[model samples]
Target: MDEHPEPGHDPAVGALDPRAELSEFLRTRRARLKPEDVGLRSFGRYRRVPGLRREELAQLAGVSAAYYTRLEQGNGRHVSAEVLDAIARALRLSDAEHAHLTHLAKPKQHKKKPAVRTQQVSGPLRTLLDTMDGVPASIVGRRSDILAWNRMAAAVFGNWAELPAQEQNWVRLVFLRPEYRDLFADWERKANDVVCQLRLDAGSHPHDPQLSALVGELSVKSEDFRRLWATRDVTVKCNGVQRLHHPLVGELDLRVESFHLADDHEQMLLTSHAEPGSPSAEALRLLASWGTDATTAGAGTPPTRTA
Candidate 1:
């Protein structure tokens, strides 16, 4: 709403950072590969294009020249399953990269409302989360839906069961409510991680309507979300340390271990306590006491954590 603005931003602030990042990444990745890598030949001619010429790649992938060009140009929105597989093969992509490529090329499904997806952890995973008693562990969905957790996790994350269902989303908590800033000791770092993981999820599960809706909501509600979403940095989030300021524990320094679910589009998250005999550990001990037997009866809570 102001006439004066920062560099690369208009009065409206139209262009986003994510798009630039995505385009650059694609260009850089493609540029590194040669014809022999994908089972093609250069014919000993000095190539006009830096990478596999756009047309050559399209031919190898069994796609139209126009379509591949559109995709590389970042103009195309939706791509079919067949084309995705073909491109994956042509690019000589690894398993992880192939999965990521599919996520990017596909379009996110449209949903009326961002209802949470049900992806419960197995008995083993639940037991594992319980076994690591000192850790603050939680299973989440593509849109940061807090699914299930251990006692410390429950305490560290403000007792999810006591909160409203719609308020369970991490993005919702971070942007919609001011409480999150106080919850994390290093709020800015946590905020970046949240958005980056969300961006990766967006790339991986393009058909997830729930995720799309949450992004739409976040982009509308928070300018920070809008700016970060524009970055387009896709990465598989696994391990990280978090400094948490919890309601009961005060503060905690914890280490995180994230395991991907087998073909379920979910993840098993375990945030283990880093220090023993420290204030954080004592707080975790208190949190465990809070979830002692007969305190609150509960069953499994399942949500996909595609990190």
Candidate 2:
């Protein structure tokens, strides 16, 4: 027998139990719906259940009440794609939420042992980042690790290079770093979006210990994170506007875009841009100038005299 077990053989990995996740997801989704929301009649009789009853959901989804109950109890076996789709429709899941449901319901079968998670930045990708002089850009890994960044990104989001590798997480910076928290004009909304994104990631990668640990730590430390996580929201990153309060340059309203790497689905390239001739564009120009001056000053400074 091999003395050392595989990486994901730990108790925590086993404890993740995707069946339980599926059950919880279904329950939460069902709880959020009301009778009228789904075109069902609600009598004046006081109901004990918070949301739609199991029978009601079953009827709506065109499934047997017993089967739906078993599914909700985590006893569902060989559930069909048709059934899953019906349930998703019954729950009125958004695209992101529906995807999360599919992930939890039918996890990928690993024919071989899972490879170790890595965040390697390709040479070509690094070269591409260097070419983006004015646009703020960063490459983020599966767990929101800041893999690499351009100079403009460093200027806008603070230099991730100065922080320890383990501290390069987006979730950690959002909740723990005061400067990062204050940077967003819509802090609460942004925080909720981030948590939702993390939840979606968790559903897809249930056995990822690093992700689990990050969630556990944040739950213990941040009340806001805990509250938002309980909502079981899921959202895919998309183009949006980010209103920032830059320390040196004042206000900046930049358009944010997230692109998934074609070679690595787990990696994302995020970039921010401002409309040409706008105040935000001018602020970006000023920021670039300041960064250039700082670089020049540092290069010209004399080396410290060491003992």
Candidate 3:
């Protein structure tokens, strides 16, 4: 008998469960559709299940019912791209959803774990953060780890230098930290977006141990994280607005922008700023002044973690 398990078989306890992910994605997508929504006439008969039947969906997508069933059952080893695309079209998946479907269907090639858990920020990137004196900015690694941050970023967001390196994860802060939860005006919306972004990241880097651990940790600790994760939503972080209740600066609105570093695609530069001459901008100025004073006062002093 072959010693190795099947291609999509669940490996060790902490490894990525690709088959389970595929199964969940297909099932959730299937459950969200109705007969009428896809132009199929409902005969006013009582339906035993929600959404379109598997056979019905298979017919619409021009695939064999048995094949579609296997796909949903997590046996879709080496599933063709053409078939995935056809099914995506049938389901009317959005651009993000379509990309996510592709990711779920095709797992990344297995690789050895890296010795270093975190990627380092480049010197030029560090200089850029320093140059942007007023704007709050930080460099984030692929796994949502805060690689580095400027004084303004440390002032606006919590102090990254104070947190233990492993604990400086954006997703962890949002879900696990009470102060962060209270900082966002639209906490629910922010939470959903962060979880969705992490889902997208997981799809892209399935074999990443650090990513898996973070997901496992959040899943175990937060019911809200687990529920949001199950929805299988995917979003590429680009631009957004953050309404923050800063402890020292009062309420301020900041525009959040994320830029993928050309030198290193796996890392991104994230910044938040307010419109010039706006009240929020003035608040940011005050924040800058306070940050400067705080830095001078604490010069040569070690950073302390904020509660």
Structural similarity to truth (TM-score) of each candidate = 0.61, 0.88, 0.87
Give me the candidate number with maximum lDDT. 2
lDDT of 1 by residue, 1-307 (tens): 2122222222243322333334544565566678777777876567766777777878988889898888876666757778878876887666655666665555445665244466666788778778776567777765677777877666566667777887787878887778788878877676777787776675655445666667656666677776665544445555777788665446777777776666566665646666778776776666666663312322333222222
| lDDT per residue as tens, model 3, 1-307 | 1223222323244466877878887888888999999999776668887788899999999999999999988888788899999999888888888888888888765566545444888898899999999999998877688898899888777676778988898889988888888778888888888888887887877777777777776776777787788787777755888899876666989999999988788788899989999999997777677764444333254334233
RMSD of each: 9.9, 6.7, 6.3
Ranked by TM-score, top first: 2, 3, 1
* Candidates arranged by lDDT, highest first: 2, 3, 1
| Regions of candidate 3 where Cα sits further than 4 Å from its true position | 1-12, 43-45, 111-118, 292-307
lDDT per model vs. reference: 0.64, 0.81, 0.79
Candidate 3: lDDT of 175? 88
Candidate 2 weakest ten by summed lDDT: 1-10
Between candidates 2 and 3, name the one with more favorable lDDT.
2
lDDT of 2: 0.81
Against the true structure, whose TM-score is highest?
2
Per-model clash counts, in order, read: 6, 0, 0
Q: Over 4 Å off in model 2, which ranges?
A: 1-15, 111-113, 292-307
Over 1-307, each residue of candidate 2 has an lDDT whose tens digit, in order, gives 1223112223333335567668878898999899989998876468788789999999999999999999988888888889999999999999899999888888777887467577799999999998999999999887678899999998788877778999998889998788777789988878887788888888888777787777766766677776777677888865799999876667999999999999898889999999999999998877787774322222244223222
